[model samples]
Target: MANPTFWVAVALFIFIGLLYYYGVPGNVGKQLDSRGKRIADELAEAKRLREDAEKLLKEFEAKRAAAEREAAEIVSNAKEEAERLASEAQEKMADFVKRRTASAEAKIAQAEAQASAEVRAAAVDAAIKASESVLRQEITGNAASSLVSQGLNDVRAKLQ
Candidate 1:
């Protein structure tokens, strides 16, 4: 009872007894359990949010793939339409060229026929003039008149 070690041991026992009487250890244990439950709830919420985000990502990916397919289909249809238009244009050009060629040939044939008619008319006039000059130089009086009239009748019959 007079020793310092004995006094220190007695003081430590009193402090432990006071802590138990005040319910300090039980309060600490309850606070630790509440903190653990809060942490578990937060982990569960995080897991649920992650699953929701994954589902949204999958939906967006499916939408993007559908959009790409639709775009490709539109491009393919446009290419087909363009090719069809180009072929139609070529066909129209070919038809136009054929019609123009036919028209040009018709005009050329008409001009050739007109030129041949003019040449024949000029030759007939030249022949008539030559025959008139020769007959006037060779013939004379009433006998010559009769002969000229007979020759003119023969030339007219041959021409017809």
Candidate 2:
């Protein structure tokens, strides 16, 4: 035992003699108990952290769902607003077209009335000139009588 092993043997003798005099077995048992308690606390802390993480995940999912619902509602509202605006624009356009058409019709009616009045005035003027020519050409009483009959017939036909 005079080799390197002699030193290891000498250290072990010192350790055993110190344990016998100081009740080192009880100290070892106390150290092991404290280590076990520390291990148990670490496991409990790990479990608590896991539960907190799960709760946070649930909260995040709930918030995401709420945001999605809100976004959908907003989109729906926007679509409705767009449709309403489109409908209003279409209605205004239709009304504008109707008004323009009515105005054009009114102008056409006024033009037709003016044309008819002018035609009637021209017809009366022509009839009066023909009567004057006949009176100047025919002087006999019977010729005058035939002229009056023809003039009356022309006026009646024009009136009809």
Candidate 3:
């Protein structure tokens, strides 16, 4: 009210003088340097931690890849073993079938030979009966005597 401009100027001068006396370039530079160093250290620590994390990730990836490859190899080996077993089983079955067929064929041939021998024996018996009947009807005494003598000689030769 009385001289407002004068009081205003005095207050401005006091404020500036305090800044000059106590502020290191106004002390702000020293304060900011300390804070900046703290911030830089924090950034470096964060960078180190990030690098460690990246290395761990790479190791895990490599391990995972190796495990997958091992699993694939195991599967391949199992498949091959199964196939080999199947092939061996098939071969054994084929051999068994062949042996069975041969045995059946041999049995059939033996049966045929036995049947043929029986048939020959039956025919010979029938022929002997017929011959005996004819001889009984036609033989006279002298002729029968001559036949009997020849039969005795043949029997003796067969015995020798």
In candidate 1, what are the lDDT values of residues 1-160, reduced to their tens digit? 9999999999999998999999988998999999899999999999999999999999999999999999999999999999999999999999999999999999999889888867765676577667767887888778887887787667756764
Better of 1 and 3 by lDDT: 1
* TM-score of candidate 1 to 2 decimals: 0.66
lDDT of each: 0.87, 0.87, 0.81
Tell me the lDDT of model 3 at 114.
85
| Global fold similarity of model 2 (TM-score) | 0.62
Cα displacement (angstroms), candidate 3, residue 135, comes to 4.3
lDDT (Cα, tens digit) per residue for candidate 2, span 1-160: 6787988999999999899779888888889999999999999999999999999999999999999999999999999999999999999999999999999999999999888877887887676668657765665577777777787778767774
Which residue segments of model 1 deviate by more than 4 Å? 1-23, 124-160
Q: Candidate 3 lDDT (Cα, whole model)?
A: 0.81
Distance from true location, Cα of 71 in model 2, Å: 1.5
> How far is 134's C-alpha from truth in model 3 (Å)?
3.8
- Judging by TM-score, tell me the better candidate of 2 and 3: 2
Count of residue pairs whose backbone atoms collide, per candidate: 0, 0, 3
Off by over 4 Å in 2: 1-11, 18-39, 132-160
